[model samples]
Target: MTAPEDAIRARRRLTNKLIAGREAQRLRPFFAADARLIPGGGGLILGADAIVDAFAQQFHAPGFVAYVRTPETVEVDAAGETAAETGRWTGNGQSGAYMAAWRKAAGQWIIESELFVTLA
Candidate 1:
C-alpha cells in the first residue's frame, strides 16, 4: 500500500478504536464539544476535553447508551492527513448528517472536529 493508503488505514483504525472504545465504556467525552469548552459553559471554545465530555453526556441521557449508532462509509484525502465519512446514526427515527474532521498528532490520528444533527 502507498503511504497515503497507509495513513488512511491508520486513520480509520483510530476512528474505529475511539468510537468502539467509547461504546464499550459507554462514554464519549469529546463528541459534543461546545459548552464544556467555554470557561463557564458560556461560549464557543472548542476544546478537546469539552468535546469528549459532550459525547459522554450524550451517552448518559436516557436510553442513550443503546441509541447511538455508527454505520460508516469513508473517503480519504490525497495528503493522507484529512478524510470524510458519511454514516447513518439513528435514535427516535431521527436520522441526520454526521461530519467529522481528523488530524495527525503524536504520530496518531485524532478527531479534531465533528458535528451531529438530528433530522426530522
Candidate 2:
C-alpha cells in the first residue's frame, strides 16, 4: 500500500518472527544498509551485507531473546517514500524505544537505518 503501512507491517513481521525464534525467515525484507545496529550510531553500514551481519549478530545474541517489541505503540511516518518508526521494546527487566528509518523501494518497505536508547 504505502510506505507507512509497509513499514508497520514489516516491523510487525520482523518482531513476530524474532519473538518466535525465527530470524531466518525475517531476513528477506531487510536491506543491506539496514544493518546500522543502532540508529544514528555513526558506524555507517553502507550495504545489505553489512546489515545482515549486524542484525544476525543481534538475532543470535544471548539477551536478544528476551527482547520483544510491544505492538501497541508502533507508529510510522511517511514522507517522500520514506517512513520513520518508533516502537516500544521490553525484556530482561528493562525497556526502551527503537527508532527505525524505512525507505520504500521495489514495492516493499526496507529498513534504511535504526537506533535504540533507554526510555525514561
- Candidate 2: where are CA atoms >4 Å away? 1-3, 39-47, 58-64, 71-80
Q: How accurate locally is residue 45 in candidate 2, as Cα lDDT from 0 to 100?
A: 59
Error of 1 at 45 (Å): 7.3
**What's the lDDT for all of these models?**
0.50, 0.60
- The TM-score values for the models, in the order shown, are 0.55, 0.63
The CA root-mean-square deviation of candidate 2, after full C-alpha superposition on the true structure, stands at: 4.0
Minimum summed lDDT over a 10-residue window in model 1 is located at 32-41
Maximum-lDDT candidate: 2
- Backbone Cα, N, C clashes tallied per candidate: 7, 6
RMSD of each: 6.1, 4.0
Candidate 2 colliding pairs, count: 6
